[model samples]
Target: MSQPPLLLTVGEIARRLDTKVHRIEYVIRSRRIEATGWAGHARVFSEANFDHIASELIRMDADRHPSTRSNG
Candidate 1:
C-alpha cells in the first residue's frame, strides 16, 4: 500500500524556511500563495504549496528591495 503524502502547517513551513509565520500569513492574505487544504481552522500545505510559497516569498522580498535584485 502507498503511504499518504506529508502535509505541513504554517509554523512548520516557517521553521523549515527560516521565516516568520506572519510573513507566510501575509502572502496568503495577499493571495500570492494558497493552502492545499484545511485542518480545522488551520491551513495545511503540500510539498508543491511549500515550493510555491517559498518562491513567492523570494519574489516579495525582491519587490520590496529592488536594490537587492540583480540587473543581470
Candidate 2:
C-alpha cells in the first residue's frame, strides 16, 4: 500500500522558506492559496502550494520594486 503524501503546516513552510508565518498567511489570504488540509485551526499545505507561495512572494517583491520588473 502506498503511504499518504507529507503535508506542511504554515509555520513549517515559513521556516523552510526563511520567512515569517504571518507572511505565509498573508499570501494565502491575498492570493487565495488553498490549504491541502488542516491541523485543528492551523492550515497545512502541500509542496505544490509551497511553490505557489514562493511565486507569490516573488511577485509581491516585484510589485514593491517596479524598477526591477522585467520590461519584456
Candidate 3:
C-alpha cells in the first residue's frame, strides 16, 4: 500500500500565510500563484511545494523593494 501524500487544504494555507481563505482561493483560481494539485474540486497543495513557492514570493518581494542606504 502507498502512503497518502502530504497535502494542505486552502484553509490551512490561509492560516500559514496569515491571510483569509478567500485570498487563497483567489490566488489558486486566478493562477496568480504557482501550485500543484488535482483538477476541479479536489485540489490540494503539497506542503513542500507551497513552502518553496512562499519562499520564492518572499525573495521576490525583497528584491522589488529598494534597500535604504545611510551615510555614517
Whose TM-score is greatest here? 1
Summing lDDT over every window of 10 consecutive residues in candidate 2, give the lowest-scoring window.
34-43
lDDT (Cα) of model 2: 0.90
Off by over 4 Å in 2: 1-3, 69-72
Q: What stretches of model 1 exceed 4 Å from their correct place? A: none
The ten-residue window of minimal lDDT in model 3 covers 63-72
Residues 1-72 of candidate 2: C-alpha lDDT, one tens digit per residue: 998887899889899889998998999998898889888898789989999998998889898999997789
Each candidate's clash count: 0, 0, 0
- Which segments of model 3 are wrong by more than 4 Å? 1-3, 20-36, 39-42, 68-72
**lDDT, residue 6, candidate 2:** 77
Candidate 1 lDDT over 1-72, as tens digits, reads 998988899999999999999998887778657678899988899999888889989999999999998889
Model 3 clash number: 0
**Candidate 1: residue 56 Cα off by (Å):** 0.8
Evaluate all candidate structures by whole-model CA lDDT and list the values in order. 0.88, 0.90, 0.67
- Tell me the deviation in Å of residue 1 in model 3: 11
Instruction: Write down the lDDT that model 1 would get.
Output: 0.88
Ranking by TM-score: 1, 2, 3
